[model samples]
Target: MNRLALLAAASALVLPVALSAQSPADPIFSPAAVRAHVEFLADDLLAGRDTGSEGHEIAARYVASQFDGLGLKPAGDAGANGVSWFQRIGFQKTEFGQTPATLTVSGAGEAKRFTHAGDVLVGLNAAEPHLDVTAPLVFVGYGLENKRLGLDDYAGLDVKGKIVVTLRGYPKGLPSEEGAHLSATKGKIAEAHGAIGMLSFGTLQSMKARPWARMVQMADEPDFTWVSPEGVPFEAAPGLRASAALNDSAAQALFAGAPTTIAAIRKTADKAGGKPKGFALKTSVTIRADSVSQRVTSPNVVAILPGSDPKLKDEYVVLSAHLDHIGVSPAKAGDPADKDRINNGALDNGAGIATMLEVARAMAQSPDKPRRSIIFLASTGEEKGLLGADYYARHPSVPIKQIVGNVDLDMPLLLYPFTDVIAFGANHSTLGPIVAKAVAPMGVKLSPDPMPQETIFVRSDHYMFVKQGVPAVFLATGYANGGEKAWGDFLGGAYHHPGDDMNQKIDWDAGARFAQANYRITRAMADGDTPPLWFAQDFFGDLFAPDAPKAPK
Candidate 1:
């Protein structure tokens, strides 16, 4: 057995004895209850619950009905009825037009051309349908400029009016949250450097995990972003003429006559404590893009259970899960009899919403009430770049300061009898200890993130809350008790695919246990006198909300 499995086995021996002494009251979490909800949400009738689609509306109404049945009050958009259970989120969708894009690199007495959507993928997030740029190319390492960390890829580079070529992420050994921040803002950094265009290539690790073909397939789909009612695009980066991601071959062509190859630069970036340097590429490139845009609205289902304590009642704890999925794939021939075209998302998020519903039911029915109000939010458009959560965070139904903490559920991968879980963002706040305490009596271990390089913390709905200065935790089944292989196989085979249907094997009991653990964590936070607080010197807290108060030393 692997080391993680051995550790899990060793822990399992002592956990039952420890848990047997403090079991909670009779079964509030039922596997049958969770499965029932999943069956309905993942049913084919819902048409995969695409954002802004009728299927998504059906799912939202279902969640609203559950909250109503549990006696939770509406806490969504203010309406003629004072408040409704549907918070409307407006979005603008952009689709790249089918104009054959070309990237031509010419220098060193040689030239190469790459076809868009194949050898490369290009798009503009702006509303304008067309953009064209011809400029000199310069390598900028990872294009991260963080003065505090003494890392600046553009320290001595002259990239103004040129195209900046960079890798997908920051160098190794940097804090994951910091790296995530740098990577996210790289485009802005390029634009700030007066670069007219940008070209990025995936790191070897990223490319291996998600192949170019899969990325190309998804790139063909429309991109959506939350927008204002006046139809103004939100925070669109200015001065970027064009942007594109190059395939491996296309990227390697940029360094044909340079002293260091792309491979060498990647090697340097991947090394422990290594920092790649920047240099001008011995090439010139031209890019052109075409796109179209439209507007749509989606609903975020929100409900509230008022707290019993007068002093703490105004504070709120959010239980969040996305209700949207990728929906049906574009129809094609040769699909297998069992292979439905719908990306049912039974595991991707039907399971998560089911867990959230069960948690809501348990909390609403409990005789002992929490001190803080609990908001059960079934967010829309998560698959479309966390639109619902982002909108809610920016335009909260309640006072933003009152929303103290968030617990997000998404794609838990309950394919095995998991004895441990990895709670993303747990270590950044006092929520870590609360999670530890809550899971102890359930014979479950709280494991550190096994794949920090993936930056899982910033890739989900909880990150929306984190960005708004809320302390949050996103829980997932961990790679313990022989679950590593299970998770890997699932991601490789079913993730975001039509295979994520109800036909896949799932440990319903594990789902129930997972919900129970989340319930305990939420209950502890609600009943506690103080809200969840950020740890002192946390990278995310300091970067996103420097003025927010920190936890007691």
Candidate 2:
């Protein structure tokens, strides 16, 4: 049967009255229901639900309609109707011009010239339309400076008025989120140390996970950021004059006369936990780049289900999922035999949003109402640097303090029958115990992140909430019952590809189970008297919410 027919059949079997009377313990997550939602959202007609596109607007309307049917009050920006189901977010899109970026290395040997998008990938500085820099090169290992962890790649080196070259990533054993947080500050760190330009290359392990060709392909895409009403783009790194990423060949050229090869440095850093030594290169580097910018607006679908307890109704627990995907790839042309070019992100995020929809349905229909309000947010522009979530965090519809916690669902690969789950950010808050309690009866085990090197924790929508001091967790199917191989295969073959369509195999039962687990976790958070708290000395809590109350000693 088709997805719509299967949904109709399932709905016919369950009477409306029975559904309304169903308890939280009863199985309300129907595989057929979930499949119907996924198939529709992931359909080719949606054009991969690209942010700000007509298809994305259609998906947003669909989500708003579902919220309306569930009796969820519109909690978004106010409109002519007094309330809207969408929190409109404005963005600044910056696309680098076709003017080929130029990079030249000179020293004791002949200077080599590298073309843009060929041997090096140069990033445009939106703050400046043009950039030109010439400085001596200095290797700064991972370019990380963390006083808390006593890691300083520039401890004994002086990079003043020079270009800093660094590899990507932090120490191997640090929490994945912490590593990500530190790595994100590399540019700022370089700027602080008087560096004028920055050159970065992926480590061998990192390059193996995501190839250089993929990175180069993404370099041409327009970079996006939520902008102010005055049309000012949010400046993430203020002082950097020039920045570029080098492929293996370009990196070798940069290190032509150096004593150690890039391979040797990568192997040493891998074995010693990202502690490679820093040294002044015998070569000097120069760079030039150009770019153009435009402004656009997108919507973040928002709704709320009020709590039964009058006193606690003001507090909220957020359930979030990104509705945006990579969208249609211009690089892939469709053939006459099979003209399918849309990404159709069935697993990357169609599964996540569908799961959120089911969870919302269950919460709305349950006889026992939660003590705290539940907010459903289908965010946009997550595929573009978490723009929607970051915007919401900065300009929340409600008071930021009233948001007690967040549970984010993103890309729960359900190709196999998963018996375990990996909950990123679970270790730093009370939400961890709540998840453990909620999933015990379901015969599902909560496991640590299987691929921490990828820094999965800070790569999703939930990290925005964490940055705003709200405790949060991102859930994913763990490596159990052959799930590891399934996940690896998907990441290698279909991730961000047009092949992640409805034609791919999926275990609907597993998807339903995953949704049910999330529903229970959300229910527990809403029904509990106490709100989730950050553990004592937690790095995120200390950094983001220093004055907030800590967990019990």
Candidate 3:
């Protein structure tokens, strides 16, 4: 009962009515509101709030109770128990068996075998629990294919009945977001080309940027995927039954007798404007996969602010934030006596949920509501490949077509006094101008993406909505006014670490302004005469909503 009151007062207080000249123009948003929520959510009591765990359930219920207090309508599933604020989603967890999957490269004098957890990191096949497949190897520069872009990494090579060896990432010169989208379609393109297996390795540049040691640590974690209504996990290419990501030693051994050595490819990948052509390797590879699968479930807390206007009430705007983080870690061999193993994700997502709650409260308290209905979604399993958002997009409580736009709040680094902001995917749709106009009054500048090489356009929960033909924008504090160093320090040190707790020097002032900017953007989209639309010639717009009307950006 005491915790419930804490949840209710999470947005009540932290600072005075106003802080400085750079503070939000509106007094409704307060640093106190953002601080209280972060403090409670990131507290050690939640135990990191992993998906499907009791900690995360408490987090979901807290959001649901907050929605109830705001007088928002339940926007989830209908059952014999009546309507509820949770859209539950089922999931499947596939753990690789004790076999310790092996990948063997043959035809280079003698066959060489690489074992999982040592030379290779391989996930379960899911479709065929125990898989032993062998096929010829083909080197496809980046394994990318696009007709409009005049790029065909598999130009004249026939990859049918073969395993494709691809260099990680796309060409360096293409548009960042569009390039990212295409880079992510490697599996889809491989399946379309009739490939039966895949092997990928990081470029030297990428390996240097993000050390292979980090990848090794991450490989220890299990993988998760959402289950379909058909009771199967979603596999982009079910036919590509065997796949693995290789490290330097394994990659070098696999390219023993190839036309172009892996070292040459690595050098080419390091240089800008460098591209390699496709060629069949003088080798064949075999992969072994054995997996154990289990069923699990989680919920997406949903609530709706019904529009006041009858004509535009059907059109909806979604404001979403994830509520899950990596759970407590197992003790390492050489750990400190008093180690903090829990991964309390304060800025990673607790800040996002807090900001969204404040926005919902502001709209509910206002006498004048937007013309279009607003859906506040507290998603689950986002840290596990954006599963919750993907599920909600696939099985929306309301008609999917009625969802006009999405504003996703993920990790907003509020550790510095931010003067500008970066809104990913904004340029691809009309939502860009709306956000710019919305934040201009608050002395906040909308800056362009600085780390384009990271390819963050499709990393967060909003990408799911974009894939479902909805125009979406993901907002975060920009790399300005000490933000660059703050982001760098966070990503390098505390991200996903036990150190991401409430003890960090977080700037609540910046959080209040960020919340206000996002509120204005969402409010403007909901109240506008016309709903947000995709750009006339954008890649994502053409790919997802070919028949829908597109406005010039």
What's the TM-score of every candidate structure?
0.92, 0.91, 0.95
Candidates ranked by lDDT, best first?
3, 2, 1
* Clashing residue pairs in candidate 1 (N, C-alpha, C atoms within 3 angstroms): none
Model 3 Cα displacement at 17 (Å)? 2.2
Q: In candidate 2, what are the lDDT values of residues 1-553, reduced to their tens digit?
A: 1353344234225432222223456556777777777877787777888888887887888889888888989988997779999998888888887687889888848888888888898877777777777889999999998788878899889999889999977766666789889888899899999998899888876687678887877768888888865667776666778888998877888888898889889888777465788898999888987888887888999999999999999999999999989888874444564666789898889899989988999888888888999999999999999889988888787899999999999999989988888889888888888888878778888888888778887889999999999999998888999999999899889999988988888998888888888888898899898889998899888888888887952
Q: Highest TM-score, which number?
A: 3
Runs of candidate 1 exceeding 4 Å displacement = 1-27, 107-111, 336-339
TM-score of 1: 0.92
Model 2 TM-score is 0.91
Which residues of candidate 2, in runs, are more than 4 Å off?
A: 1-24, 256-264, 331-337
- The sequence of per-residue lDDT tens digits that candidate 1 reaches over residues 1-553 is 1132222123113212112223666235667667667777777877889998888898888889889888999988887778999998888888877787678888866788887887888765555577667788999988998877878889899999999998877777888867886788887899999997888987766677667897788767787888865666675456777788889888888878998987887788778657778899889887776788888888999999999999999999999999999988886687667657888898889889988987888788889888899999999999988889988998887888899999899998878888988889989998888888878887888999998877889989999999899999898889999789998899889998888877888888787788888888889889897788998888878877788889853
For candidate 2, give the lDDT. 0.85
Per model, state how many residue pairs clash.
0, 0, 2
The alpha-carbon deviation from the true structure for residue 134 of candidate 1, after best TM-score superposition, in angstroms, is 2.0
> Which is the leading candidate under lDDT?
3
In candidate 3, which residue ranges exceed 4 Å CA deviation? 1-16, 19-27, 269-273
For model 3, give the 10-residue run with minimal summed lDDT.
Answer: 18-27
